[model samples]
Target: MKLASLKTVSNAHNDSIWAVTWAPATEARGALLVTGSLDESVKLWRGDELEQDGVHTGHSLGVIAVAAHPSGNIAASTSLDSFVRIFDVNSNATLAVLETAPSEAWLMQFDLKGSTLAVAGGGSASVKLWNTSAWRLDASLSVLKSDASVKGSEKTAGKFVLAVAWSVDGKLLACSTMDGTVGVFDVSRGKLLHLLEGHNMPVRSLVFSPVDPRVLFTASDDKHVRMYDAKNNSLICAMSGHGSWVLSVDASPEGSALATGSSDRTVRLWDLSMRASVQTVTDHTDQVWGVAFRPPGGEGVRAGRLATISDDKSINLYDYS
Candidate 1:
């Protein structure tokens, strides 16, 4: 219903923290808070006290996105330089390093089954999928195709892919581009199903509802969050409040609520049933870049938790119930 501030860590990173996600708990430990930053480091924290568990540094540029495999043993991170590193969560051992050149990698996500890693290709106008078993390049799902004669730089600038999301069932994959087009694809057949259009500005973040696979939510530079029925290709509704770009969005595990981070330097809690923002938390001094909900299942981990990272070089934890 609402988020109550539990703890705040200042200077959590040397520079701006750009991304955050919770690694599911294993028999050895509870879920760990994973954060990537402009400092070119990825750090892991444990418990509500936010103790530092580990720090990984290899990225040549600022880390842009981080994702945890469903099994919780493996994690991956992408940097601005377009390189992806997949590593072991507990041992911090490097598992694989993927070089995405020609096409840039902006955001990445592991499917529900952890069989594939999907990276939003910034300039390729496609989503690149890697097979987890072999850690090999699997396929590239093109969201937009232009004339072959179009110059590479011009084509990339026009339709850069910024974000990607997997449906609850892992049957569908949705990717958003710089031109405000959201493409829904059928993973099995590797075909684009439809494009959801409404916002004219870049759509930076998106997610599929946990309860309904067909329902999708997107945050855009247009300063509004729009809900759509991806399967039907229909816009359901749009909610507005953030004064600047909506940077990130995540749905509650129960699918009844949503959480978002914005350039307005605030984290907002949205009541999905009401389709409006119910609470705003202005705890960061600069832009709020990432917000994530702790995944369910752990040793006696029942209470809900939300973690947010900001350009202020801080991390905030909230008690969600």
Candidate 2:
């Protein structure tokens, strides 16, 4: 299937859509999309019409990360303010407020079991874990100083934690940092497991393959996307083509393809088996910050769907299949 932009919602957001995730469908509500923006607001959108369901504002700075709980009833968002806000998806009501000052925050994610939330602690050199039941710090997984760890980037100023992903089983957590180093950790043990190496620029986005626990993919400012064998901590392959920085990357729910948005004003589709981009959508006039494949679950929206948000102040939807 080829991509023909189905709809473009111009000025849907005031700034870049930094993160996006699909809320699974419920008996009462169709699947919704939760997006965070540099505008310092987290917005919920009705997936079908792209209508504003609601907006949650309180973050002092840009909202960098957002994830929907597996239960679909709740979601969590983290901001540059070092705060994580857990809110009810349906009502857009605040549920829990989590914060850590000494350990700053970046991207965040919830485990598949919906029992824990993971926050990438920027510069704190740790990934902080929170218990969803009590909304308290459960553990802190420290990054190691091993000789084998990926060397810090010479050009980058920070080892600031930037992105995070949890294994499908919720046992393994991988966090990427500003220096382009990815640290894999064993959540239950609170230990640093291994570091995935390759990119030499900030790794802005990372995701574990939905169907494989040992596979992880990362998007970096180095203009490349890399796949990893998480269990062995080895770089499997790298896909490079974006002319500018790659801001975000996501895997399709079926786990057969992936999507990426870049500062070059384009969104790309890659077939996992071929490990090559099959199509490029260049409708945006400015940087495209986030791209996501809608999670599969809704009864009616039974198609492969992709959404991209741009610094052009637009949100574009495409049919993936």
Top-TM-score candidate index = 1
Error of 1 at 246 (Å): 0.4
Instruction: Report residue 195 deviation for candidate 1 (angstroms).
Output: 1.0
- The residue pairs that clash in candidate 2, if any, are none
- Which candidate has the highest lDDT of all? 1
Cα distance off (Å), candidate 1, residue 179:
1.0
Per-residue alpha-carbon lDDT of model 2 for 1-321, expressed as tens digits?
A: 456677788887788777788878888877787888889998888865689898988888888788888888898888878789889988878999887784478778888888888888877777888899999998877775545456655223465787789988887899998778898988777778877888899998999999999999999999999999997889889998899999999998889888999999999988999999999889998988788887787667687778888778778888878
| Cα lDDT for residue 231, candidate 1 | 87
Residue 64's lDDT within candidate 1 is 91
- Candidate 2: where are CA atoms >4 Å away? 146-158
Global lDDT of model 2: 0.84
Model 1 lDDT tens row, 32-110: 9999999999999999999999998899889999999999999999998779999999999999999988448888899
| lDDT at residue 15 of model 1 (Cα atoms) | 98
